[model samples]
Target: MIKNFTVFKRKLSHVCNLKPYKDTKWLMPNGNPTGLFVYNCVADQKVPVILSDPHIATWYSCGPTVYDSAHIGHASCYVKLDIVQRILKSFFNIKLVTAMGVTDIDDKIIKRGKETNTNFKSIAQQYEYEFWLDMANLNVEKPSIIARVSDHILSIEQFIKKIIDSDMAYVTPDGSVYFNTAKFPSYGKLQKMQDCGEPLSVLKRNKMDFALWKGPKPGEPSWPVSWGEGRPGWHIECSAMVSKLFGSQLDFHAGGVDLQFPHHENEEAQSCAFHNTLQWANYWIHVGHLSVKGDSKMSKSLKNTISIPELLDKYSADTFRMACLMSNYRYPMEYSDQMMQTAEETLKKFKFFLKDVYVYVNNNALQNGVYKDKLLDDLQNVEYQNLKFLKSDFDTASCINNLLSLMSNTNNIIKEKNGEYYPVPIILIADYVTTVLMKFGVTLKENTEDSVSNSIIDTLVDFRHTVRLNALTRKDKELLNACDIVRDKMKMIEVQINDSNKTASWVFTK
Candidate 1:
């Protein structure tokens, strides 16, 4: 393990170089963007994400607003990010400090509150709980710090005050505060905005200027303020949370590409201004948007979004994660029935393969066979390759391909061995595959239907044996009926029954 980790650390400089490097960032399988283009604070613009410390990484991701149930679009974004996190922790072995900020107080929350006739706080809490349950179901790693926008009001107020004092922000006659985009020259750099693209907010002098704080309003969630009673703006929540959690800077900041605009851009602007730092985060990472029917982005306006809970009802969490990862993170995911069905099938393949291994090892793999040396050689070869792949970026996709190949070869090997040879090699291969997959939070259990069928067959076989004893002693016509019942039951399950006058036996239909 030490040697394996060292091998990765040595290869790390090639990707996350501290010195400047420049290369065109291309989406490997397609000619698409990898969501956020690779940029580094140190050397080359071609570099993916270079850690600020170049040792351990500090990451901040903009979490959900939690006003309503999460959809497949949400799952795609989070799953891609979760895959990155898994790679970081499992392969790189870096000490990662990840912070995800949730906007528990927002306009959406208020609107949801009114619609549900529930308090905004209750709505936020309910959805927040739902969000986490869905995240956990999809195997997303929980953040080290969960900063609710509402919880960081004091910090946000202090941050806005500093920017205002610095003349980087301004307060309007209505007591609402706004970030002075005009005061910050490179204000829209993250968004690449050349001109104001939308209608102007009344509080700001410029269209690009965004709200820092809105003054008091009746029947709305707000915090006390000398400027007026109001809650933090959408962007400021993240800036304040990141500031409180990791000082002013982050090694990397991630979110869906949609956030690259005003949300992340605004967060970037306020952070740089408030911290007196050029760029608050070293790397800006993003995931691609998910579309429904490959037609439009999943939004409430179209009413085409599929909620996570809704999808989970038909497919497992692993299925969703698999489908999301099936496409590169940079490419948009189309929520097509075809994609889900494919993912479901892929999941079954993995589960079926795992169950086969489990049964073989428990039932047939008991022999201390003669092919120990050959088994050791094969296991060692695969282990080394798997570890090497785990250490490299863009290697995970290939890793899956390799596993499929191994499964194919193992199936042939099992047939040739006929349960006679060493099971060590097979055991080792399955263990390695499973361990590596678990990094992505893909857990495989024995095939449910197969397990259930086996259990039922066992019970039926025992019951038939007892019934045959009574029927035999009586020598009655019911003897044939009793045997017929067992045969019919077995046939229903596709289990072929073979009966002798003295006993009954069964095997799966060919």
Candidate 2:
């Protein structure tokens, strides 16, 4: 028998066996229902997620352990979460108070301590700084709080005390404390299994039971505690941080799928045990893995992990971000030369489309006020279309694809003769592209220039465009010859000029 739920506190929106509906007070404004759902790893289905408060959301993401440099595999998780937060804030209009816990004191950090012949704290900080720098480079949104376990030791100790007082945790003879999983009853539901990994120490009551606090180990960092001079276990750090930071519950708990087992499962068990609630986090959001071309997983043991610094050295961060967004967040994304090359090429294409639009819109600014085109009229309710895509479980890839397709047609208008060249439609199409790109950590730069030389070039290009457009219908040989002279002269300075119908565009190929 698989015991799925246990007795718990308040009426959670979507937790354990209880599924609140349209009438539930927690849904939205006066409990009005809305189209919101998540592919919950816990429920293993697309469960409706109605936050305790629609306007304000409390989210927590499990951060790096900080023992080693972050890999691209690590980038995949954080970037995906960043995009999720952006959509929640932008499209869903949710004000987010997001927290990410950094595991600065862990077994991995201790191992690095021995290797470096230094205290674990320094080693953890060194890599933590590097990890965050990489995150910034990748355009990941900064978390509202970066909670380090070492900094929150007091709160962690107090958390352990509460669990102990609840009788769900026991202090062993060695002064280490362990959460008795047998007491929680719904302990295995997150990972959806009953059998746990082999006990880390024989002091634990059951093989499934995990440590709330570990006893002092030789050469490892330790803090003075009532139970013992030791650090909190990996699982307990996240659990305690969630409580100390966001009370006993969260709207969302996010991490890689690898954490679903002993890490997240143990956190879920400890949370419910400490709070006496069957549901702790309302929604469990997990990101899939980033695999190499030939490998199934990127692992240090397998000698296959690709570091972030290595990737950043070769490709632009935006290209890598594009790859992440194009791939489904729920599925595994393979890192390959072909995949990355495709991403680089894709970004270049978007750059090219924008380049043409910028030149045509700004140069023809005066005439565009009266000029109208049927193709431009076809792009209707783009905001509505984008929002509709967002409402459907945030299919961001499709949202991007929609813009790309629209731009493809828009680009056709720019490229082909008799195609429309107007500012409003160009702005309309670019607006859609820019809106989606912002969600993916991409910014479309519109730098202002006031240089006299630039103004001269802009005026010259506008003159060439005007004359060539006039020459097209007038059938004046002398005016056509003047257009050719301007084109030839611009080309001499490495500028490429092309004429399609009434529009003459020039680009500095150099």
Candidate 3:
């Protein structure tokens, strides 16, 4: 493993020195993004993500509001983003530095606190903890930096001051601040709105203006500024955090598609105005919404959300991850019992196929066979090369289809050879499948592991058989179920069971 790690590092170093891909043309079977392309929400088209620096990429993702429990909708957004990040680092070899902001101070938090008779900060902290726990259960990777609104109040104040100083924002008489939409001509460019259809607030100068700071209300949390005490608005927190971390510009800005209008548009306007740059971020990536039945979005307020913990209790994290991967990132995914069932069955079939390959490799030694099937080999190479193109385009759904095709061809070869074919190509297919799936966070558990000796497994099997016989003689359903439970549990320890008419046998899979 150490030698392999050293070799991988050396290869990566060599790849860094090589010229980058000029277009959507891959470097052969290597899955480096011919050019990393992600859908830019404002541009409304897929744009290539080029690193400003040599090997590092900078990204900012809008995080949860942290006022309540995170649900499957949150899981869908974060897991899809996690998949993109993994591909960039592992396949594209681009080091990513990402920042996600937690809206720890918000109107929702204050409202919830008033209802529950808890402090707003306490409510925010509790939900924030729950949010991270949900992320872990779903196997969503954490961002490089987690900036909370409460932690960056000073920076946000400075940022608002900068916007006010630039004459793009103004301070209200009550110490509130508002972004002057008329001053910035490209204010609605992100949303591509021809008319500012947003309803006008009483204190704003124009109907299109949005709040930059909220003046203090009775019993609400407030931060002191030069004018008076107030809290940062939703849009300003993100702009402040992004500017603090990535400075003038970043490679990508990402969040759910719902944020594209108003939230994202407002963020873009303020960030660009603050930095005095034409663009605050080079590209924007938005994950499609996950909805419940019909057109209703899976949201907390709708009372239609499936929490991450609730889903994980019924299915494995990898199953849910695969469910997300089975759909295009830019498309909405419907969450249903049927969708989850399909995902579970699909994952199980893939795992069983991988287990068969592992069993064959263990039973037979590597050798060259006289009967070489040209079609199978050709299909294998073709599918392998196709992955580079599919993944480079951020077409993970098609990449999965590419893998399924490879697995089907390999299985056909295995059946035709009747367990007597060359092992080299077969193992290569297994390795390739494993590598692709690992990038998606679905690890195959067919690999060898440290386990008990063969004798110990034999002893356990004999004991289980004895119990089964006793239960059979007594016709006890409870005892019989217990015997079955033991057999099923053995699989967790890398033991396989084969049942006969009157008895069961076991083998050490490791």
In angstroms, give how far residue 306 of model 3 lies from its true place.
1.0
Tell me each candidate's TM-score.
0.77, 0.81, 0.81
Please list all clashing residue pairs in model 3, or write none if there are none. none
Q: What is the lDDT of residue 119 in candidate 2?
A: 85
How do the residues 46-134 of candidate 2 rate in per-residue lDDT, one tens digit apiece?
65556556578889999998888999999988988888888888878889999999998888888888888988889988999999899
lDDT, candidate 2, equals: 0.75
- What clash pairs does model 2 have? none
| CA error at residue 6 for candidate 2, angstroms | 21
The digit string of per-residue lDDT tens for model 1 on 44-142 reads 243444443434778898899888888888888888888878777776676789989888888988998899899888998998999999998777889
Segments of candidate 1 deviating more than 4 angstroms = 1-55, 359-395, 417-422, 446-454, 457-510
RMSD of 2: 6.9
TM-score of 3: 0.81
Q: For model 3, what is the error of residue 82's alpha carbon versus the real structure, in angstroms, after optimal superposition?
A: 0.3
Q: Which candidate's lDDT is highest? A: 3
Ordered list by TM-score, greatest first = 2, 3, 1
Can you write out model 3's per-residue Cα lDDT over 105-193, one digit (the tens) per residue?
99999999999999999999999999998998777888899999999999999999989999999888888999998988776767767
lDDT of each: 0.71, 0.75, 0.76
